[model samples]
Target: MKNYTTPILILFLFLVIAIIGNITISAIGLFFNHDVFNTGVYANGYEASLNIKLIFMAKAFALLMFIYSVYILIRNLKFLVRRDFFNNKLVQCFSKSGKLFFFSGIVGFLASICGILNIAIIKDFGSQAYLNIDSKSLYIMLMILGFFLLLFSKVLDKGNEIQQENDLTI
Candidate 1:
């Protein structure tokens, strides 16, 4: 069995907070406005449908993805901070993880946005609008994950540079 350290505890806490926040926001939206669903068509005559519950769910799911991404971010950040934000083992881990997290976050964020927009459009123009809810939601989640990966990669590159410099000095 492995022992849980402070950093792990912090990571766990962050995840809980993010997930809770996402769920809470979704519930709030669902509760406050239950009559926001409708069906409509756009200028192109495409069909679309929007439901309050769906919108809430999409947003909540996106937020959950975002939270996971953030956890990766915080993990890297914690490492950087512990390493004094320099080139070291912990920082290296952070740098790598941070990029991964950033990409994930971006993907999730985009997907969430797309889902939200789709719901909004369907609500206004009718459910016959031109957008797929399930697909968009998936993209949003991917976007979140992608964003984290991007960020982590960038940071890791920087860490590598610093490490090289230190090696040269030694």
Candidate 2:
């Protein structure tokens, strides 16, 4: 089973790279081709100079964090293939991956908030800014998944101790 782990890890790494590439390309296209700057008006019914660049920067930062988390996960998977599942290094890798996942979720949530606030601040005082909760759910899911991963690392640590004891008895 361990012999197959390497190939699977490689496949997943390639998949993550592909996904990142696609997202980068699409983001570049959207940022350059769309007229996002002139789309919104100020609270006083005047054309406001909305800093569209900040929106792009926030999105890019979130995407980079997500990519970084995926990279950490892939690195951990590679370590799992090369070392014992119960090894200290493997535990560290798992812990790091979990933290990265949680961090990515926070960064994504903040990005959404920044984007929404940017629009709201410039919009008419009485008019409501569109609040989309779709990304919020995804962010929450990421946080939960990260928590589970941390819990799993604890379980693996216990398993490692049991395996060590069994080895000594054998």
Clashes of each: 47, 0
Q: Clashes in model 2: which pairs?
A: none
TM-score of 2: 0.61
- Leading candidate by TM-score: 2
TM-score of each: 0.40, 0.61
> How much is 155 displaced in model 2, in angstroms?
1.9
The superposed Cα distance between candidate 1 and the true structure at residue 156, in angstroms, equals 4.8
The runs of at least 3 residues in candidate 1 whose Cα sits more than 4 Å from the true structure, single-residue gaps closed, are 1-22, 28-55, 76-78, 82-121, 124-170
Every candidate's lDDT: 0.51, 0.60
Off-target runs (Cα >4 Å) in candidate 2 are 1-51, 78-83, 124-134, 165-170
Residues 1-170, candidate 1: write the lDDT tens digits.
12445667677787687568546543533454322233222335433234544554554555555455556555555455454544355444544454544454454456556556655665443431212323454445555655555565567668778778898999
